[model samples]
Structure formats: structure tokens, C-alpha cells
Target: MHKIEELKIWKKSIKLTMLVYQLITALPSNEKYGLISQIKRSSVSIPSNIAEGAGRNSNKEFKHFLSIANGSAYELHTQLILTIELGLISKEKVQPVLDLITEVQKMNYSFQKSLETKISILNTQS
Candidate 1:
């Protein structure tokens, strides 16, 4: 199995999750059950999925989890944009987190593609 902690994408996702937590603190308390919860959940999902995927036995399973993580990253991106549009947080403050999410998303995509190629090669050999 691969080491989840050794993955750069997982590390970045953890950092992004922490940053999201910090950002949400500035949001109004009424949103605690709304945007705050949504953002937090999506942010955490990225790394959680990556770690879970890495623990799996097959590359296909790993790729599936990575795809899920990528989806969460996109979900987080949308929530962040909604938060800014609602004036819950300023674009200036949210931009960095958004950028990090984007980076993680790209990394996840590349990683998934690499896994697909590896799987294809393995299948061909078999």
C-alpha cells in the first residue's frame, strides 16, 4: 500500500482544511449549521478520501477514492464562492484557500491519471 502521509496532495488537503476552519471563524454564527458546516465537511473529505484510497488494495480503488476527493474539492470551491458572494467572507481572504483547493484538485487529477496508466499497464501485462 502507498503511504498516504507521504503524498503531497494529502498534505496540501490537510493544510487547506485547516485554513478553511480558520476562515469560517470569521463567518457569522447563524451560518454555523449552513455554510460553515458544508465548507468544513468538504474540506475534510479531500484528505480523508485520499488516505482511505491509499489504504486500499487496488489501483482502481485508489483512483475511485481520488475521484471522490476531487469532487469534494470542487464542492468546497463552490461553497467558498457562495460564501464570498453572500458577503460572509471577503474575496481577498477566501482567494488563498480557493487557490490551494485548485492546486489540490490539479494534483488529484494528475495522480488519478498516473494511476490509470499504471492500471492499464498492469492489465496489459496480465
Candidate 2:
């Protein structure tokens, strides 16, 4: 199992989730059950999946969870854009969060590739 605390991706995801929570507070109350709900879930999913994958017994399992996390990151990305397009938030306020999400996405992709490489090597040896 991996130490989630030491994983830069996991750390960034946690920060991303926190930023999302902060952003949602400025949104309209009417959206509490709509976009707000969706964003909250997706944002939390990023870090949650990372922690889950880190606890798993195998690299393949971890990679699967990381994939789920990355999907959440993209989903969050779209939702953030929607907030801008809907006029609920300004692009300036949301851009930093978006940039952080992108960073998390890139980190996830790199981490997944490393896991894939390990899986391939183990399979070859087997």
C-alpha cells in the first residue's frame, strides 16, 4: 500500500477539494441542489478516490481508483466552467481552481503511467 500523505497528487487533490468548497459558498442558493451539489460531490471524489487507491493492495487497483479520481477532476473542470458560463462566478475567481485541477489531472496521468509500467514489468516476469 502507498502512503497517501506522501503522494503529491493526493495532496493536490485535497487542496483542490478545499478550494471547491470555498468556491461553492459564493454560488446562488437556488443552485444548492443543482450545480452546487454536483460540484461538491465531484470535488470530494478526487481526493477520496486517491486515498482509497492508496489503501489498496495492488498497483492495478490503485490505478483503477486514480482513473476514477481523474474522471472526477474532469467532471469538476466542466462544472467550474458551467459556473462561469452561467454567470454564477467570475472567471478570475475560478481560474486558479481550474488551474489546480489541471495540475491534479496531469499528475494523475503521470502516476497512472508509472503504475502501468510496473504492472507490465510484473506481468512479464510472471
Candidate 3:
């Protein structure tokens, strides 16, 4: 029941990952193992870590995973910035991805805070 599968964050992460993949595929062949690979890894990690964290038995564990997911989101954001800077992707394309990154970051932080509160409550109860 504590799984992120039930979370709006997880849902949006899934959508964002798909979009990231699609965008990367359009990248030039020269970036295949560079920007493209990094983008894919960072994008996929967001949702993967979120789900992994959700599967943990404790709120602390879940929060740890969400933290990892947040890191991945930041990593993805950096890659987006680089892509724009390198002229691989246009400024317009950059904004939407950046927007999604912002949203994911907020969601991950919210999930982490919620988990922290739950852990605190449990700690107080024991």
C-alpha cells in the first residue's frame, strides 16, 4: 500500500521517461553513447528508483529511494541543459523537458517529506 505506484509522482515519472526516450532517439548518431545514453539512464532511473523505494517495508527506506530518484531528476535536468547548450536540442524542446524535471523534483520532494513524517510518527510511537 505504500508503493509509489499509487502516487501521482510515479505516474508522471513514467510519462516523463517515455517522453525522454522519444526525444533522445531523435538525437544525432554522434551522441548515441554520450548525451543519448546519459539522458536515458537518468530518465529511467527516476521511475525505477521511485518504484524500488516504494517496495521497501519502512518509511525511511522509501524516503531513501525517493531521494535517489530526486538525484536522478537533477541529473536529467543537467543533461537537458547540456543538450540545449550543445545545440543538440532546440530551446523550445528544452523548456518542456525542464518543466517535467521541475514537476518530478517537486513530487519526489513531497514523497520524501511524507515518508519522513511517517517515520517520525512511528519513531515516537515506539
The list of candidate 1 runs beyond 4 A from truth reads none
Higher-scoring candidate on lDDT, 1 or 3: 1
Question: lDDT for every model?
Answer: 0.95, 0.97, 0.87
Q: What is the Cα-based lDDT of residue 24 in candidate 2?
A: 90
Worst 10 residues of 3 by lDDT: 1-10
Question: For residues 58-117, what per-residue lDDT tens digits would candidate 2 score against the true structure?
Answer: 999999999999999999999999999999999999999999999999999999999999
Error of 2 at 121 (Å): 0.8
lDDT of 3 by residue, 28-89 (tens): 99999888889999999999988987788877888888898999999999998898898888
Kindly give the stretch of ten consecutive residues in candidate 1 with the minimal lDDT sum.
1-10
lDDT rank order:
2, 1, 3
The digit string of per-residue lDDT tens for model 1 on 36-110 reads 999989999999999999999999999999999999999999999999999888999999999999899899999
In candidate 3, residue 120 scores what lDDT?
A: 90
Residue pairs clashing in model 3 are: none
Candidate 3 residues lying further than 4 Å off, grouped into runs, are none
Question: What is every candidate's alpha-carbon RMSD to the true fold?
Answer: 0.5, 0.6, 1.1
